[model samples]
Target: MTVTADRFDDALRAGPRVVLQTPEGVPLVMTLASVGERAYAFTIDCLFAAIGLLALLFLSLLTQFAGSSLFGAVFVLAFFLLRNGWFLAHELRSGRTPGKRRAALRVVDARGGPLEPLAVVVRNLTREVEVFVPLVLLANPDFVLDQGPGLVRAVGVVWVAGFALVPFFDKKRRRIGDLLAGTLVVREPRHALQADLVAGAADGEDSRGEPAFEPAQLAHYGVYELQVLEKVLREEPTRSLVLDAVAEKVMRRIGWTGDPREFGGARPFLAAFYRAQRARLEHDLALGRARQSKTAATERGSRPSTMHRNSQ
Candidate 1:
């Protein structure tokens, strides 16, 4: 019943530890943005909205458009665009609004894939209902307790409280919109991680000879296990004891045969294994059968073989 790291391998999958798995199956670990962080990002976005509103105001003044019916219609349209379209346009195009990017956060699917249009629209539109409307109603002096209907003001208070409180109760710190839309907000991964993993593994002396793994050997484990091996190999080569022990553990897990001592050295065995696994992952990706974690792989296996490779 024990869950191992290989149990789930969607690298870009969001969690407390954000793991961004590339198309080639390399994983870059990241951290999830906190609720406080999310608030800061939102505040930054509000600043952008404010600036947009100011621009519209300036345009109205210069064009003598203020106080005219035409200006009122234009103002409403601009508000809708700056309020709703701002989030929709930015999230759909790049998965990050200006606020999110400044906060080093990006939105992704719960399963660690790219954001889809439906999800983007749902989350942002819901924000209007859950956040904007209630705030505007409550904050407007015309709608205050002494000036407006008691029932309406009371309803506004309750609506804001409920929606704003949902995130605090969820384990993932998900807002109501995020829960409904199946989305998560997480920190962006460091840019250098990919280069470090690939570049270090590519040093000529590390994996000098051509890999000699058989098809069966390569099939025993998928990208998840290969990533674990990569981490081990990337450790200091002079730490022979650690390398040997990790290599032996990996071999046992994958049912790899032959003595480590006979394969030049533990480091070489690891390097060659990495080469084979990476090559296999690349081939599988090209075949449109990209490697998934144990759970996804099992689910995939249960489906009919006639299913196309791209479906995986």
Candidate 2:
């Protein structure tokens, strides 16, 4: 088969993506974060850290009369803490730092599982060797030696540059920290919910109002599941088997004890469940509770569980 020019253009235009699995045996295509995006995020994080450092510097000047030894020690300790703790605290609390959040990026398990705190620590701490050490060498070559060796400084610089370039070489665009911690930085897909079926149903709808679903029952699923349901509902009505399977899963989740047949059919049952689930999700969204998926880590999260799809 001859490849068309359009196909070649499409291939060239596509960015790097990795395929992960959902618990329900579905395939999820995750887009790797671009170099430009990562750099943007890193710059933002550094800016925030710099602001804190500047504040501490001002405080040190104010307390200069308190003796250089006391405040000098405090300055060093605070510098180290602010420089690293800023990243550790934010990442441990939520996989994404303020920078990652603003960039719409996240760190996920490379092996397709929940991101562990240990992994977060490992990745963030690598900044010491990967970034900090290199920066010091560049700025002050004699950091290690009284008269920093020219060869040694050059070697350090090259090593750091190599680390910086690792992502360009890796198929997944994983850098040193990500490779060591088995994590990946993925960009969240910007997916908007389709036009409100629940609201539209208010006028001509008949199947969704019969069975009342409780908040607790409706809370079993999240935006991810809701989108999947929406995808199904938009297809041709003849795909009854697909609807039946999806409906069964929803019933199991909501602990629907009533018969599926009694609800009329898969279409009606799914419609009712959809209405309840949408209302539940909307309420949560309004309250600033973002549940990307059922298994998504909570602050313990994802959008980039937008890393947490449906899986292990």
Candidate 3:
């Protein structure tokens, strides 16, 4: 069965599906995904960056103890430059979103092609202006030079006020930078089971089979099980509960007697199923494009024949 892009979008908006692209070219959809894990990872990275910056500052101060102000300034400049460069490179190569979700998030154009390098650069660069007020004031004393003392004090007040209003004004919890980047931060499911179900249904396949089991039948399984089996596909223990005893219970509830072990130990099964479903969808999409191309060519070829007949 072929899942259309509209259906995929609907699932994402509805919060039951995370659409991921394989290292290959297939799009895998899964359910039970969340942004929490990714958010946590980003927090860790931020902590690392903070520690590194502090270490750099300490080293610069130590060098200045020898009365080499020039060397200290040079070192500081180089440190900041390298840090920003690395950040841009990493964000472009992976994506602007931080954490494990970075692995599952697929960057694509409106036409569904891979994202262009220029687009990534423009978006990340815009962060400079969006995050300008806070970043400049925090790091550089020069930011206060142009204004009178009174104006400088007012600017500080405004900055504090703006920072305070951030959470209230932004619906997505984006800071000022995220708003200017024209980027979206979405959570990816730990697994692709939900994506597979929706994609399979779109393609005219029955995911859970005939006579869909009632929600109560899923009682033996916890929320994590449903989430892991349907949402995020990561192998973390917290997200692997579905593949444990919970999965077997779900299978049993559905009247399946096949050994749970036969499904390649849960995680692999979920991954493989999503991969297969994505491949099938892509294959179908390609065939459709091919048919459209052939039809257009035939019409062009027949145009000359019609013209000749009319001229005669």
- In terms of lDDT, which candidate is strongest? 2
Summarize candidate 3's per-residue lDDT along 97-169 as a digit string, tens digits. Answer: 4443443542333223455666556655654444444556556645644556867766775765476346345
Native-referenced Cα lDDT, model 1: 0.71
Query: Can you give the lDDT of residue 190 in candidate 1?
Result: 57
Model 2: how far residue 293 lies from native, Å: 33
Q: Highest TM-score among the candidates is held by which one? A: 2
Report the number of clashing residue pairs per model: 4, 7, 20
Per-residue C-alpha lDDT of model 1 across residues 1-312, encoded as one tens digit per residue = 012233333343544664566556766555678888788988999899989888989988998888689888888898988988988899999998998999899888876666779998888888986677567656773543446677876775786667877777877777888998998888885555454444544566554454467777777665555665665666446456767776777677668787766656777777777777778887988887755433457655442221222344
lDDT of model number 3:
0.45
Candidate 1 accuracy as TM-score = 0.52
TM-score between model 3 and native: 0.39
Candidate 1: 10-residue stretch with minimal lDDT: 303-312
Candidate 2 Cα misplacement greater than 4 A, ranges: 1-14, 59-69, 144-149, 196-312
Per-model lDDT = 0.71, 0.74, 0.45
Inter-residue clash pairs, candidate 2: 297-300, 297-301, 302-305, 302-306, 303-306, 304-307, 305-308
